[model samples]
Target: MVLAFSTESLNGLCSDDQLELLDAIDHLRLQGIDHYISLPQIIVCGDQSSGKSSVLEAISGVPFPVKSNLCTCFPTELVLRRTPETGVTVSIVPDSSYNSTENGLHKFHEELDGFEGFPDLVEKAKVAMGITTLGKAFSKDRLRVEITGPDRPHLTIIDMPGLIHSETKTQSKTDVRLVRQVVRSYMKQPRSIILAVVSAKNDFANQAVLNFAREVDERGSRTMGVITKPDCLVEGSGSEKAFISLARNNQVNFDLGWHVLKNLDSETQKGSSLLNQRNVEEARFFSRGAWKELPPSMLGINELRKRLSDVLLKQIAFELPSLIREIESGLDESREKLKELGEPRRTYDEQRLQLLQVSQGFQSLVEGSVSGSYDDPFFEDAQSDKGYEQRIRSVIQNMNKEFADEITAHGHRREVGSKSQTPDQNPEYVTREVFLDHVQSMMQRTRGQELPGIFSPLVVADLFRQQSSPWEEIARGHVKKAWDSAVKFLELVIEHVADPSISNSLLEKVIRPALKTLLTDAEVKTAELLKSHHRVHPITYNQEYAETIHFPGSHSREEISNIVRSFFGLSSISNGNQYLNNNNYNLSRLVDNLSKRVEPTTERLAASEALDRMLAYYYIALKRFIDGIAIEVIEQKILVPLSDILSPVAVFKMPAKVADLIAGESWESRSKRQDLTKKIDVLREGLGTCERFVSSRLKDEQNSQQEEAAGEDLDTSDLSVGIPTASDTEEAGVV
Candidate 1:
């Protein structure tokens, strides 16, 4: 039934101030602020053919096309505004799930002065949204119908596509999921008051809308149950009684309670005065039947309209404060995004300046990181690996300590019994005696014209080279690890200081090549440091070497004596006097000759001496190598160059064309900046609107209190003296 437009029909339902508040929110919604923040509104949702569109039509007094077998395929938003004249405008708000440009959904708009062509407009909207019986079954796009008339209440009600129970030939499983997704998206908004429509012809338990409502608003704080088609139930039947109980809020109770309405039957819909006939039949059916027990507030479309209006107002009031806070937060985030994108670098000069700025920031952060001065906010998350990686000094120090420990534990080729071995000692180690036996074999093979006690000095160099072989691989690995950390830190700094487009170009054109060069230089320097020990003769003047050298105490005098006897093929004598008394030898002379003999024992002693010198030299060289890697290669070659890789001087020396290529904005960056700028503007305006609303509300409250105080001080005698009270002024039409 089409409701008439007149000034007296909808006036006094809400105060002018409340209407202003609703209008302000509506204005923000139209400006697309609702995409960033949820706005307060009534959303009608239910299963297919659940009379949801009927409820919307009853409240809005606009003819929403409804059929017995057909169901809504898209969301329809009815925005009713109170104005002096009647007007209507139809438009399409393209669903965010689809690209408006590709779909051409943003091009649909129509204006009308009346509702005569609304049904045809609805058909056109469906076609525009690509909804058809054989083709698309549903859409996420919204068909917005703004109705402005003198009698229309200031409200907005959205009628969403009904939920599907299962898939059919026309509606696939994808359509069912899409419809649920669309319904749940609206219900989940904190500011939306859910009007869950349930048809009385079906069992409430079978309907899924209430379950969805409870899922989103579990407490039912913002959900109201609306039972439609009450006249369809037979009087005094079990179904009618159950619906009556539901209308009384006894069955399936909600915090917002339940409402019931009777929509126009098919026969009544074809006749004139459809609104009057439907209202009369609904009232007559409820006035004397079991439904009479229900509250009047829960019956009829008029009371439902008032309840929805009040519910929306309270919801808006309850959410406005947090809404303002959300807008402020959104504004801050957009500004930060814009700042990260930086100023547009269109010209060569501007691009050069941008690169210089980025270079300055990169150099500053690198210097702080390399020097162990982690005072920057970026280094605050020290517990995280990213933060730890950025602290170059700490990472390098840990790496150096680990390198030294590895060398100490695995550096020696043999384990001497004289010294205790580390827990992590290399498994390839052999006893000193076994090592010396191998050394003696080598010595016999390389025996020069020299005496048995003396051997080639090259033997010591060979032993040292083999002992320190693991050093080069270990040092190279450590260097590579430190280089990786430096690269990670550089990438993080670039990302922080510049846009993605600029950062990617800078890394490709400048930072990567520079780092590659530094890595090669560091590796070469590390190899050179190892070469000095590998190719050259053992050389160390440190006094610590002399202190470290000690004879192998595990060797006994008997072992040496046995070796000497075996080498000369001599038998053991019963007494030492037998050899001394021989005419060929004198006692003192024989002892001196035995001590000076170039026997196998002399060769063993030479090997032992060589081993002791090698051990001492190894200790000294290990310390020197560790220091050289940490200081000369890691610090000087890699880290030191990193701090100046993107320095101001380097940026200044760069050609303008190269700087432009590295720092110029790309299409994505420009689009992102533009989007952020528009968002910032919308948020600022929304923030101002909320602030003005709050200020005006507070001023009104203060004025109300002051007037009440004045009224309280009034007396009969004061009125007689021609002093007008607030009530008196209002009665005289002066306020």
Candidate 2:
């Protein structure tokens, strides 16, 4: 039987106001809030017997309501599967009933069933649920039994008042309506997947009972329909196909919400629906022509039970593609309506595709480099270069070049070192400066230098590497191609710096901060994926990568631009607009590359995770921005304008040189029109200072942590140097 969950639609399942409710439920689930509403406390209400107590007995394993006319005089609650180790726990948030006269009565029946000396309860009870009482309430009398479970049993499911009592219309009394409401409210919880037992005989009164079930089953995801008396209704005629039709239709008749268990078999089967569904069908092939007329129970419940061992196992067996498609559709709708930021490029799928190509490409390249003559068709210089050089540089630049102190320190220092020399001083600094000075001395040579840093050893060294491979020297006379590629990158860099809009000062200001922030943020986010337990290894993590998306901020142009500004501050004096656009593009590319390396499953997986992560991070980034702006706002509002504010480290932005190279000569003029090149140079200067402070803070934090971790006699040397210090940086960049 389809179990009737199929007809239920999750459409409009959650209202806007219910978002918080849903979120809260999702939160409880995360916390494993396995809580079920408890009862005497939970008086199930339905007219007459309505099989209410049968549900209670089945769920709680305690019998009640011997017949239809009998009132469970004691108002007893059966306890299911319990022990004494874990205390009985319940949560009761009372429903508002202050104005009702019924609320005035203190309903306590004083052990009417067993309390020998207690008086009967009034219409209502003064006893209430509180921190001290939790949800427990004491009645003067009536049936009340509490069972504690072995472990903290995941929540409680209570069967309250039987449908239609002798004295009350609701299974619960009017005085207990507040309590009933509370129980119903708890059942509505999003994580509380409910299995509501309904009578299958299909009577008008029983149908009303199903209506209540429908009303309570608001969340399509949480409600399931369970028909109890199949033996009476379909008898042996209920074949699997027939039962599935009936089971699947129950939701239609009963109003259960969406989310059908795909598998026909739910967790447990109380009766023997399978005897005929399975064995009867199987037995039909044998000499069962006469036996077909017999009920399996005629033989024995055990034999009937044996007929259903495998067939009765409750499993969700719907086609997975449907579920996946449904989820994806829901995700898309959610994304469009859910959050603040709308990023078309928010997905890492394209990036993942690129990474896949690169990963496979790099492996191929490495194998090619190592290939012996015997290896498959080795070419002296097999690389295709029409666009090969450009693509290579593109990948490297896309890798995001970092200019840590150590990087610049590499070729910085001059041949002449003063006594102030620290072994860690960057050699790049001295050498590059010397090269610059030499060019100036040969100012006559500057006319030919074409570029300010044209003769610099840094460029010369790069030039050399591109020309010679470990295995061969620029075979096929590709020397010009390599030189041309190098020259192209150089031109891109020089033109960007020389742009009139870029002042050395502003360049100094924005360059370091933006780039540093971008790269580091990307790294941190990428690291989060790598850190996920699902990742088998760092490199292999890419194989398992997926993307998620959500909006974090408004789609308003101004608001979005502001987010961009807060994230990638412009470097120029005017802080032109194009720079912002260009920066965004580059940052996106870089973020994508890094993210893909962390998780590179496939197009679909990439899109999903990229979207989720974007939503998560954008929220975080916006929060950071708000905090930062708030600090400034508070400072502005205060009597004393804040003299000090924590300036977060600027992540590495796409370098202007690289951006220029990407733009090409023509793309440069228009692309960098408002670009801030020289301004970024100043940013670099500020970054130097920021780096120093951050480094000091990091060192202090490390030292403090180490000291705390150390014993009284611990040696300083006992602490191993971990992450390289700010000034003392490590070099891991591509050559």
The best candidate in terms of TM-score: 1
TM-score of each: 0.67, 0.24
Q: Candidate 2 lDDT, tens digit per residue, 30-117?
A: 2222222111112343433345444443333222324222223223333222245523222222233342224422232232322211
Cα-lDDT of candidate 2:
0.31
lDDT of 2 at 418: 33
lDDT of 1 at 428: 56
Candidate 1 wrongly placed segments (more than 4 Å): 1-17, 46-51, 65-71, 82-87, 113-117, 149-153, 162-181, 184-190, 196-245, 255-262, 265-299, 322-355, 368-516, 529-636, 648-684, 712-735
List, residue by residue over 312-363, the lDDT tens digit for candidate 1.
7766766776787789889999999888787888888888888888898898
